[model samples]
Structures are given as structure tokens and as C-alpha cells.
Target: MAEPSLKRLQYFIALAEHGKFQLAADAVNISQPALSAELKRLEDFVGKPLFHRSPVTKLTAAGEALLPYAKSAVGAAHRFNEYAAAVNTGAPTSISIGTVATFLHRGLPQTITDFSAAHPDILVTTEEATSAAQSDMLLGHDIDIACGHMPLQHPGVICTPAARESFWLCAPTGSPITTIAEAVDSPFVIFRKSASPIYHDTVVGICRTHGFEPQIHHRTASWSAAVEMVAHGLGVSLVPSPVARNYHGDERLIFTRIGTRPNAPQAWITVRREDQSTLIGDLALGLVIASEALADPVAD
Candidate 1:
């Protein structure tokens, strides 16, 4: 029997992971019909029905038997590709990183600089992506490294906790919002809930704990934009303490203790557990080193 293509194998794994054609298509960056056609081709190669396409896609008995071997073949091919890349370069080279905006502005820049300095031979690149997108990209073998918030649970992706961050208040420099309660009447700029539900709810929870719901004046996707809005006197906003300290803003901004429990995203770094490259391990360690400074509390 003729062999199936690697592209088809990847689509097969994506479908198996996601369990829906549309979802799997998005994960693998292919059209749904295209993914379906590729899987059909794979099924034909084995001469058995692979998936029972119904209201819910499920593996037939034949597919159940083929799944493990398909995964093994795909994983072996991925390792060989990485090996080939290294061989062609004659040295360890080219690491692609996926990160969130928060970390891109936080400790990630420093970490990348340090890693690049120490391993000048390796070409490093970073793509800004949401934590959810990072998981998909990692599973698709697009990125060698991922850095984002914690509590991500994706099969075959290994996440390591790097550091914790505290939340702070960023008010207009001349505004009298010295406390969380003081901002009760002031308009607030918060993260849009659809973009980051945890962050949106936490910022709201902080205000509710202070005995008044925030009069939300604006919503933003990133803390960097929230801080900018606050600096321009658009609205008072809560910001992660590390970002408040590390992100340079002009005199228009003032960061203060909001007197609530730290409400920042816990930092995490992710890589495919299947990838056992030492270069990835060393780069992850560098991120850990850079995050150590963020662990120290920033005084109000």
C-alpha cells in the first residue's frame, strides 16, 4: 500500500485532538473541506474508514488501531525535520517563539536578548499570540517555544510555571485616586472580557471588593493600552505590577497599590513535550532566569 502524506497525518492528529472539523481546521490553518479531503485520502491509503463523521466525529475500530502508529510516525518525522534543520545549518539554529503582548512587553525582551547574546549562532524569532493561539501553534509544530499565562491544559504541550505577578492601579497622575475605593467614582479602563475573561473579571472583582462597582469608561485588549489610556487621562485602570514597573511611561501615569490580592496573570512557558531539544531547554531556563527579578515585590 502507498503511504499517506505528512500533511494528512498532521490533519489527522488535529482532528483527533479537537474532535470537530471546523475547530481542527482552524488549529491546523486549513480549510474544513481541505482537511476532510486529506483525511479521506488517509482513510483510503489504509483501506478502512478512519472517522465516523456524524454529529460528533469519532474513530472507527480501524481508526482506533491506526491512531497510535500515525502519531508515532508523525512524531518521528517531526524529530527528523528538526534534526535536518540542525544538520543543514552545521550548528544549533533558528528558534521560533510565540508570546503574548503582556510578556512581550514584560521580561521576554530581556530574556531573548540574553539568550541571543549567549547563543549568537541560533537565530531567534518571536510571534505575538494569545495563550490559546500559542497552544494551537505549539501543537501544529509551528513554534519551538511559547510564553504566556498559566492554567493552560493542552495535551502533548508541557507548561512550566516561571513567575507570579501582582496587580496595581494606574491612575491619571493628577487624579486623586490613591486607593481602589477612591476610583469608585472615576471611569475605569479594563480588559475586554472576550479577550481575557480572567483579567476582566479580576479587575472588576477588585473594584467590587472595594465596595463599589467600577464605572467602566473603556475596555482594552492589553495592559499596555490600558496604561496608555490611563496616562492620557482617558480612565483609571488596574495594571500588573511588573508591567507598571517595567513599562516606561511619561509623568502622566501613576502606579499605586490597589490594596487587593495580586490579580495578575501567572507567567508560564510552554513547549511540546515531544520535543526533547536541549536548545529549547536552555532557552526555557533563560526565561526562568529573567523572571526571577519579577518575583521580587515592587514597593508601592
Candidate 2:
């Protein structure tokens, strides 16, 4: 019997994900005819059709049986390739980090540039992930570090005090929001109800404490979209203070304090098993230094 081809396994997995032969072929950088031929070859080798084709794809029992093994085989091949590249070409030491969209405007770009300049041999990749996704990334080793608001508790992670991020009520420029109650009454453009569990709950709790539920006129997953919605007078929003700084001088948006008694939760930098790399250690230290710069001065 002929040995199973790694390429065939990869193609199968892609087909499963995309659920379309032509699309999967495009994704894998091959022609549709080539993809179909390869799938036919694999099916013949195993003496079974892997998929039941239709207007929409559906997996056969054989396909379902093969899927997990295919994923593992593909994953191992990727790991092997990464290891070979890192060993042979001496690729820059790398770290994957996760942060919120808000930091995409404030500190993240500068920090990444400075880190690269200081360590030209190290590669840094940034991913915009929600707090929960960030936690999942760290635990799964998909990322070396995650910089976002505190994620729920996990046993093998170390969370550092990154920064105290705040939230503010934002409205269209020149719109009067002289009263906290007025801010609460306005139609709101809210972040996704699933964005952050704590923040979502906090917003609901705060509204109840204020004796009124916000009139949520729109819900969005994109921060820029939410800001644009506010700017267009679709609704006001409660957004992170760092993001507020970006729109602070915008002629189309106005940001006001969220009451003195209440503030948004802090952001933390969480790391998985810390012994992974020297470069990650350095990056973590630099984040601490940057966080200190942003901190309020406290007298000793």
C-alpha cells in the first residue's frame, strides 16, 4: 500500500473547514481540478468516499473519522516546519501577544516598534483578541503573552499589573451631556454583549444602579464601527479611556467621565509558563516599564 500523503491530509482538512471544493482549492493555492483529483486519489487509497457532496458540503462518516487525525497531522507538520526554520535560518526570536483594539491606537504600536528596534533579531506578532480569547490563547500556547483586561482565573498563568484603563461616555461633538442621567438616557451603541464578561456585567449593573437601563440602539463587534456609530449620532457609547484619547480631539466626537465613583476595570498582562523564552521575559519587563510611565504618581 502507498504511504498517505501529508498534502492530501491538509487538503482534506481545508475542505472540511471551508465546506467548498473550489474555495478550499483557492485557500490551499491549488486549482480546483488539482484539488478534486487529489481528493479522488485519497478516496481511492482508502477505498471510501470521504465527503458527501451537495449544494452545501456534508462530511461522510469516513470524513468525520479522519478529521481529527488530519488536524493533528497538519499541526505536527507546521510545528516541524517552524522548528526547522528557527533552527536553520536563525529566525528572530518571536513572541505572540494579544491586546484589545483600544491599545491598537495608544501604546501597542510604539511598544512593538521600540521592541523591534532594540532587538532586531526578535519577531513580534500582535493579535487583537477579546479578554476571554486572550486567556484561551495563553493557555493553549498560541500566544506567548496577552495584554488585556484581567481574564478569568486559570491555574498556570501569571498576570502582571499592566495598566489601569478607564471608560468614558462618548457622544457626537457639541452634543450636551451635562448630566450623568442624561448620558444614561441617550440611545446607546454598545459593544457586543459577549466582548468581555466582566465589562458587560458591569455596564448592566451600573445602569441598574443608576435606576435606568440604557436604550441600546445598536450593537457592534468592531471598535471603529462603534465609534463611527457614535460620531454619526446613531447612539452614544461607553468606550475605553485609551480609545477616548484617540477621539479626544475629534471634531465629531465628545467624551465625558463615567461618574467618579465608578471606573472601568484594569488591564493585565498574562503569561503562560514563564520559562518559555528570554525574549518573552524582556518583552514582559518592557511592558512593566511602560505601564509604570502611565501610572499615576504616588508619593512614597
C-alpha local distance difference test of each model: 0.77, 0.73
TM-score of 2: 0.66
RMSD of each: 5.8, 6.0
Q: How well is each residue in 1-300 modelled by candidate 2, as lDDT tens digits?
A: 686788998888889889999999999999999998998888898799999987678789998877766765565466468768988999765778888776565467778889999888878998888887786566545676788756547656677766555557778987887444787668888767677555555556566777888888898876688899988989787766566777778899878766532344456777754433556766866776676465433222
Q: In model 2, what is the error at residue 200, expressed in angstroms?
A: 2.3
- Give the residue spans of candidate 1 off by over 4 A: 1-4, 10-38, 43-79, 88-92, 247-249, 263-265, 296-300
Name the regions of candidate 2 deviating beyond 4 angstroms.
1-89, 150-153, 261-266, 274-277, 288-292, 295-300
Global lDDT of model 2: 0.73
Lowest lDDT 10-residue stretch of candidate 1: 257-266
Please give each candidate's TM-score. 0.74, 0.66
In TM-score terms, candidate 1 sits at 0.74
- The residue-level lDDT of candidate 1 at 162 comes to 68
